[model samples]
Target chain A: MSRVRVHNFSVSLDGYGTGEGQSMEAPFGHAGERLHSWFFETRTFHQMQGRPGGGTGADDALASAWGPGIGAEIMGRNKFGPQRGPWQDEEWKGWWGPDPVFRTPVFVLTHHPRPSVEMAGGTTFHFVDATPQEVLRMAREAAGDRDVRIGGGPSTIRQFLAADLIDHLHVVLVPIVLGRGERLWDGLEELEARFPSVESVTTPSGVTHLTFARP
Target chain B: MSRVRVHNFSVSLDGYGTGEGQSMEAPFGHAGERLHSWFFETRTFHQMQGRPGGGTGADDALASAWGPGIGAEIMGRNKFGPQRGPWQDEEWKGWWGPDPVFRTPVFVLTHHPRPSVEMAGGTTFHFVDATPQEVLRMAREAAGDRDVRIGGGPSTIRQFLAADLIDHLHVVLVPIVLGRGERLWDGLEELEARFPSVESVTTPSGVTHLTFARP
Candidate 1:
């Protein structure tokens, strides 16, 4: 069955999915690339950048799962770009150049909706203003036989989690304490009960990979 | 050299040390015993209650290190009891009953300073309003040749961590999410940089033990 999975979602030790002060320059804010440094070092991530010979250990194994089996993605507006409020102009395609990594029917949740734009590598950006459930219904339809991925900016993930829609979640606990940022676990009371099968594995990079899956 | 260490500090997957709504009845608030259920199963914790024959594995080994080689403990006012603000009366010794743990000088950080109350088993509760450095100075002096422990209620630990006083920290990541509570990692920006030697171990109880030691 197709599932709603969150893969390679990195959070600080303090449960912050991203750091504060997210801008066009600093997409992850002061957290910068520290939260995703582990992923950057992985062989899978290197392959995405058209680079060869990266670490092929546990980190790569998990990083490699991001694209496979994912038909569509539901991402917050922040993940698409740092442009908040109404779009200043449609010129801001995304943080990624013409060829974005998603390469799927990516639904961007925003208050100000816009027309869908198709990018290179089979990636299409669809803007919608709706609740998580409503957007998820659309994403599920777009996903069809494949699974829908909840690409997050913390608040987005929290909403889906609060709605009990996520079936599989892969969270990487980065060693750094972000101190102040958008926290992902807010209002997720008694989260352990929802996911019975939880496993943790520590890679050589000193980050713990926690996977929570519903039975 | 005597060290300042934190052992067996339990936190939820969301990085909450304890849940919200802490009162006299709920020492750990709504978190209850869920955060510490793993420790309770350990032989060291069972032995604390005068019980016997508990598991002697990794969890037990880590739990057993709570007391030995520690001469003094510096804890936040919340950890002692749920009585916030000024001391209503000097009668509340602690929640640990007559035979409380920590057979040494235990300094409780509180604005309303009360006279020292010596409890059973050589545990002396000394209330004082001082900074982490000031309290640590007194604890180190009282400890003599032994080490001091920075006992916590999240906020207290964050203070010590901000001051860069703690040399060793052992944080257990419980798989639960309290949603609302006092977080331990607040204001501790880029904490991983301070602790160079970090390690993680997953036990049978489905909790990952993360140890960070300053070089």
Candidate 2:
């Protein structure tokens, strides 16, 4: 089945998912950069940046699992950038420069619509203005046998989680606390019922790994 | 074995663990309240708050796992409260009230030294002015066989994480974007090397249950 998964999401101990007052310079925002210290140094991340001779380790192993068979991706407009309303200029790309990390068909859930953006790599950004269900249908169709990964900024993932559309999730619990900022799961539990099982691993590099699956 | 563990810490996705401004109203500073949504409504949380009847699903299960079996806790002065400088008032308990959640001996890492505070519950607040290692020794002795939980605002967890002292951590990836706020992990990857493998679950309630343990 084409399951929807949230992989390698980073969070703070104080509970906020993203930091406050994110600017163009600090897209993740103030302390937000601290969340992914584990993944950024991984061999997989180095490889993605086109660096050679960098490969496998515990961190690399986990990083290597990031995006492979993920046929499509779902993200909020914020993850793409801070621009609201309509996509005025075509010059705005993601924080990752030209070629983004997700090299698949990326579906961005936005209130505004724009033409598809084809990058140098296999990535093609698609803007969808419908409900989460409509976005999921399109993503699933684009995904095929592969999984559909939800790229975050928090709100996007919360919508999918609220609808029970995600199948599994992988979170990297960095040992820092954002005393303030955006949260990952705000009022989600207040909305409905839930059942989830979790398993975990702690690595030597100060990163703890966790997986959540439905029983 | 008294392994170091980072517990109940929250951070912003932008890399900030806490905001710059410190005040009672903005406890965590600006949007800081968003980080702790997960722990507030869980069955374990309710049990701690002396309440009854909460969602008993995986999210609740994860919530219950956060506050049990820790012999000691370490926190920064910022986490202890917005009160700075010296010990002015004897009646300044934490924001959690007289009977705090952590019923064990709590160590506050700070430059200022204050006498231990014996609360209504089994919780005792001990202020330490020495280094993190010094505090760790005290907490370890206090913890015995149980894990030594590093409880903090952000800088505290970062210091511990950089020292490679944390063994297990569970960072709940809440789904909200601050756009601007404190970040969790900013520049610590060069000091440590680990990737997180995750265990996760999505409750119909919208909160995703994620677990991470250091191996």
Candidate 3:
């Protein structure tokens, strides 16, 4: 069966998935790259940037697994770009330039639906205005035999999590505390009951990898 | 120099120290004993209850470190009892019966201060209406050569942490997520900057122990 998974999603020690004041200039706001610095140092991230010589530790091991079984991804509008309201210009592709990391069918949840964008590589951006369940259905269909990944900017993850759509959730707990931002765990009361099998491992980079999987 | 430490403070994956709706019946509020269940299974906790045997693994090892070298404890009023507003009756000596786990001087912070109550053990509950600094000074004086522990119910920990008074902070990350509760890391922005050295180890009981210490 195809699974809905969240992989290598980094959050602050205070549970902020991304800091406030997110803009094109600062995607992670005041948080900057601090939340994902651990991943940035990983071999997997370096490979994504078409670079060489990156750390090959436990952080890389977990980060490398993010793209394997993922055939499709569902991300929020905020993640696609920092634009709000409607689509001002059609030329804006994404933060990842021409070839996005996700070489799969991508569903972007937004109120202002736009035409499907065919980017370089296998990544295709499909703008849709639907519920989390609706988007999951579309993503699952696109995923086929493979799994669907819930790409997050915090709110997107919380919506999917609130709907109980996630099967395997991998969270990297960064040591920094953002204090204020989009919290991933908000309104997710008693979320642990869904995921019975919990595992945690600390990487050399001072981040703890926590996995919550359904039994 | 005497170090101010926080040991074996358990929080949910969402960083909630305790659950909502705290009352006399439910000391930990809706969270109940869920947050501290890992610590409760430890041999150190069993010994606190005067039990025969308990697991002496990593969980117990960390839990056992809570009492030693701690001459005094500063806890929030919420930790003392469920009674709010003015103390209805001075007879209400705390949830702990005749003898309490704290064998040292315990300062309970409250706006409505009352007379000191001496329990069976060396535990003496002193109600004080003072700032975190004032209380820390009092606790430091009481502790003398020994270290002072910040016994928390979350908000109290935040107070000391905000004041930049804690030297060593030990946190046990429980897998559960209590959706609504008083979070521990609300206003502690970039708290990890203070603690340069961080160590994490997963116990056999399925809880990750994270310790942050000042250099």
Candidate 4:
């Protein structure tokens, strides 16, 4: 079955997905790279950098799981870049270079929609000012037989979680206190009840991979 | 030199140390036994019940670690009982019958200080309206050479954390989402900076024991 999954979504011990004061230079704001330090040590992350020789550990194993079975992704506008409100001009393509990490059609949720931008490689950014359901429908269509992924910046994932749209959620619980930032678990109290199957694996790198999947 | 330590402090994935709507029936509020189910499976909890055998896993080892090398305990009024504001009467000794978990002296943090009550076994309850520092002084006196444990109910832990009174913190991260409850990490931003050392171990019971210690 084609399931909607969220993979390798990192959060601090305090539950903040990203830190305060996010900007172009700091996509994750004050959180810096602390939330994703574990990811950086993974082979998948090394491969993303077009480099080699990264840690082949439990973290790498869990992190690399995101690529398989995923066909398309849906991310918030902020995830595409640090730009907010009306697209300041079409100058900013995205945080990714010519070729992005996701080699599939990606739907960018925004209040103010813009023309679709096709980049190098298989990645193409489609802007949509739609609800989680509508965006998911478009992503699922683009996904075809494969599964759709909710590539988050916290709020986007929360919307899907609140709507009970996600089938598999892989949260990488990083051991840090971000203090202030976007919280992933707000409003959706007892979201675990929706996903009966829960599992946790703490790697030696000090990150706990917590997975909640619907049976 | 004796240190102020906190051990076996269980919290939901959403950072709630205790659940909402706490009463005599539901001490952990709506969270109920979901948070402490891992503890029940531990050998320590079994020993407390005078049972012979229990799961001798990482959960058991970590849960049992709470008692050792500790003397006097300082807990929030809520952790002791559900009674709030001024005490109705001294009839409520505690949730534990004759002998409570803490064999050492236990100090209850409250605005309304009451006369000390000595119970069966070595456990003694002393109600104090003093600040964290003042209480620490009294607890140190009571503890003598042994360490002092910061027994918590989220708000009390937060108060001690805010005051930088806790030296070592061992938090049992239970895999549950208590949407609304007392948040332990609130206002204590970047607390990991104070504790230079951090380690995590996830048990098969889907609980992660996160320990933060000072260098």
Candidate 5:
């Protein structure tokens, strides 16, 4: 059966998934950008950017799994950008340019309203204003039997995990610490206890990749 | 021998360590808060804050490594908070408040000059205007055979890695793609290829932990 999953999220040593104060200028934050250095140098990343003769290996394999054939994505408005206090307008597509990195249809959870954004790739952005189950249903329809990925910012992932909607989760561990910032998994002990098994691999770049599944 | 190390700096899957525009209110930026969620709940973090009974097993062990060290600490001026050209005075301490996180003598790498900020604890923030090697020499003196840690933003760690000054590195990968922003390992293919040995572990919160060492 197709499942909903959260894949390849990178985090810091201090438990901060990111650093404080992100903006279009600095994206991750001052100290947060060091998280995904492993993936950037991968051959897959180079290939995606249309660069020639990049790489192919375990790192490339991991990068290739990042995107491709994933029918749909679900996330919160915060993941889209830093806008708060009601949707200002659709002018802010995202930090990404006209076309986002994801080529699949994306569902963003928000209390506000916005139209769908069609990018150069096969990707489209859809705004969902409902409960986790409702969004999951919509994403499943959009995804068919392929699989639905819960692309994140934290709150969105937490809500789905809280609802037991995710089937598999792949977390990539980057080594660093932000002394302060928002946290992922701050209080999810009850939810995590339900997972039955996990698989792990470590990248040469110091990224420990983990895949957790529930029976 | 006590070696210098850089561990667990989390960046967004997007390439940004921290997000763009940094401000006092939204220090990490937009959804960047999701990046470091793991640390806030770690026992290591709580203990640093003088709170008791607030960490998970793996989380506590990692958090404990963050503070209460007699060794010297290193940081970029930006971590001392925002910078405007060179240092005009010695008054600016840090964003961490009176007690500050580091209780030992700290070194701030800057192109400017300023006197050290001595705190109640053994902490004293000193601004250094020299190469990393020079800073290392002074830090070793202050550390006195204890370990020296590279408290960083991406640039600082990259410099250390490029110079091969770090002997040990740890990474914690959370899952998320910033899709835009600064990159941690923007140009680190050679460094990654050199440090090939790696080890991994995972926590209940879906964070994959990794440690890399250069023998």
Candidate 6:
């Protein structure tokens, strides 16, 4: 069976996956670029932007883990764009510009579904109103032999985690204290039991890579 | 001025300082020594329990930092014992038995104040119902020229942190998730500004020692 994996998901010291009051101007709200600065400086992120030259340290190695083996991606609408509750503008082609980095079928969860948008690169956004199980089924079908990735805005990942749909989880624990924001581990108490084997490594950049997996 | 400090404070990956259902039998509740396992293996903790021979690594070095600091210690009532609402037993001389670990004046915050208890060692338990600021003043006075330590039960540390009384904070980030319990970070949003300088080092034991100091 193909695995359901989450990779390089960053969170603050206080457990906030993303800062509060997210908007178009500040998608991470009060958090700014603090949550993802590690990824942004990495070669993996630079490569994603189709750029050259980036950090070649432990951080880059962990950040690079996000791409491989991921076939299809399941994301919340918030990650697709800042618009909430019945899309404000049809022209909003996501924060990733005309050519999104996701070079696969992206299943976005939304209350008000819209027609699919085929972007440059191999990316195609499919907005759908479906449960985590239903969406996972669709993503798994689309993923084929490769693994399905759970792209997060926190809530989507929490729902899938609660449903026990995830097989491998990779979280980057950033040292900065966000104080207030959307938490990744709110309702999932004793979440370690689901994935018995866990490993952690902290890089020189002061971020710890926590990987939880089932054997 | 006597500096206020907290050291070796253990918190889970999800930010829980302690676990739920705390009692006399289970001091750390369902967490069950999981949070303090790093400390337990450290030579500092072994020396605290009057034992010898523990891991002589980075964890031990950081654990040893809890001592040496300065004088008096202020803590929440919960850290003293499990009993609540005006205390259950007068015979209960705290969890430390006859001779407590804290050799300095220990001020315990409680609603119902009681007469001070002089233990076998130099340790003295002073129960007072004072605000964080007021307690800090008292602790500073008791500490004299030496620094004052802010012992925690999460809430105690949070209170001191809110009052901007702590000069040094050392938090041990344990790689476990306790879904419920008192959180140390709660309302301390943008707390990073208070401490201008911060440093972190991950030990071989997989625990990160995060130090925030006003430099």
Strongest candidate by TM-score: 4
Please tell me what DockQ candidate 2 reaches: 0.06
Report chain A TM-scores, every model: 0.97, 0.90, 0.98, 0.98, 0.89, 0.98
Ranking by DockQ: 4, 3, 1, 6, 5, 2
lDDT winner:
4
Task: Name model 2 segments beyond 4 Å from true.
Answer: A53-55, A190-196, B1-215
**In model 5, which regions exceed 4 Å deviation?**
A1-215, B67-70, B88-90
TM-scores, all candidates, are 0.93, 0.54, 0.96, 0.98, 0.54, 0.97
How would you encode candidate 4's per-residue C-alpha lDDT over A77-139 as one tens digit per residue? 888888778877787888888888899999999998898989888999999999999999899
Per-model clash counts, in order, read 0, 80, 1, 0, 67, 0
Per-residue CA lDDT of model 2 for A111-186, tens digit only, reads 7888898997878899889888899899989888888898886788878877888777776766554656676755
- lDDT per residue (tens digit) for residues B11-88 in model 2: 433444555577978886765567666667667778877899766876677666656678899988888888888767
Model 1 per-residue lDDT tens digits across residues A21-91: 98888999989899999999989887777778889999999888888999999999999888878789889
Q: Name the candidate, 3 or 6, with the larger DockQ value.
A: 3
Q: Residue A105 in model 4: shift from native, Å?
A: 0.6
What DockQ does model 4 achieve? 0.83
Q: Considering lDDT, which of the candidate structures 2 and 3 is the better prediction for this target?
A: 3
- Per-residue C-alpha lDDT of model 6 across residues B40-148, encoded as one tens digit per residue: 9988878878997999999988888777967999999999999999765888889987888899999999998988999987899999998998888888898889899
Whichever of 1 and 4 has more DockQ, that candidate is 4
lDDT of 3 at A154: 93
Give me the TM-scores of chain B across the candidates. Answer: 0.97, 0.86, 0.97, 0.97, 0.89, 0.98
lDDT of each: 0.89, 0.71, 0.90, 0.91, 0.70, 0.89
Q: Looking at candidate 5, what is the lDDT of residue B152? A: 80
What interface Cα RMSD is found for model 1?
1.3
The superposed Cα distance between candidate 1 and the true structure at residue A21, in angstroms, equals: 2.7
lDDT of 3 by residue, B1-215 (tens): 79999999989878989989998899988999999889888899888889878888878888899988999999999988888899997898878778999989999999999999888889998999999999999999999999999999899999999999999999988878888788898888888888888887777777788899994
After superposing candidate 3 on the true structure, give the runs of residues whose Cα lies further than 4 Å from its correct spot: none
Deviation in angstroms for A202 in model 4? Answer: 0.7
Candidate that beats the other on DockQ, 2 or 5, i.e. the better one: 5
